[model samples]
Target: MTEYKFSDRAYTKMIFHAAKYPHLAINGVLLAEKGAKSNSVVIVDAIPLFHQCLYVTPMVEIALMQVDAYAERENLVIAGYYAACENFYDNTLDKVPAAKIADKIQENFKGACFAIIDNKLVTLEQEEVALKVFSCNDGGRWSKSNYSLQNSKSTLEAVSVLLKRGAMKDVVDFDNHLDNPKHDWTNELLNKDLKQIMAMY
Candidate 1:
């Protein structure tokens, strides 16, 4: 049974997306590369879907196609699907769109998994937490698995900005009337002040 390893940058990306829209359910694809030491997957980046209606919308399909093309060029594979729900302890992950999404990804990438953001870590305690990974078993049932994080300077910088911005303090779906631009987080990642803020931590 192959396990998943999440790079800090990729983990932060998933948390940032969940915090960005805490009230609604957010889903995304995890890009990963084969590990060198053993049979494992190293999650590299996430492509988030802020807007989702029903199951697997046409827009989501198009986005996945584009992501797959990009991943191929980068020598990465669509290794998994991740979801953050309205409630922190939402147990519908394996029963939600994520199940179908993970199944679809596994069709091409056999060891694909699903990660559900542990909402409590974001809502209650402002501390480190491990996101859970579920890999499909022989019967296509999701089995709980383990994953470790890889620390990096970029990830530290990203965390600094999230805290300084008081992102977790905001109310989820507060800006319901507004639409989130896909590059919002990317622009923040390039913010000049981010370096200054990261230096403090």
Candidate 2:
């Protein structure tokens, strides 16, 4: 039998839950924040397809079920696999308008899709803790974005100065080039970061 390891909050919670409601006892379940479409799992249940976990707990199960509810009312994003990724963003994804996206996904999932509306989907599992980021203080960016390879040194130096001063810490910038303007790496970074933060919450 293959053994699945529970590595995150969602996975562990799913394991605990399966013990109580064996019918709904999914071998494993991935989680995410409420409104986020990152498909990131805060906690994860690591159950092997034909194997089992070392141990289980009811308390943990309760917590796992509560992730979505908490994210709904609090500061987290929540969405399961199909809902988070494929079914999410109906217009952009499933092509359903924001108003009817839930219903559409539910239909798509054959009436078993889990979804939480309210847009606060980014902060479900935990409270927002103000990160004390050490970043570059580059108030002199955007101007240097047009720097070329011939002048990459000066442009890079400017950004380096910003980094030295602490600019990258104030806001998020996964794939943004403070000194380069030829790259449109926005969607990838934004989506990646969104998913990453959603799972952590």
Model 1 scores a C-alpha lDDT of 0.65
After the best TM-score superposition of candidate 1, give how far the Cα of residue 153 lies from its true spot, in angstroms.
Answer: 12
TM-score of each: 0.75, 0.22
Q: Which numbered prediction scores highest in TM-score against the true structure?
A: 1
The residue-by-residue lDDT of candidate 1 on 75-106, one tens digit each, is 78888888887766784555455577788888
Q: Residues 1-201, candidate 2, lDDT per residue (tens digit)?
A: 111111322322222222222222122223333333222223121111101221144433443345345444555432222111122222122221221322332232221222211112212221221011010113411110110121223323333333344333322111122224443212234334424533543
Where does candidate 1 stray beyond 4 Å? 34-38, 54-56, 123-125, 152-161, 166-201
Q: Number of clashing residue pairs in every model?
A: 0, 40
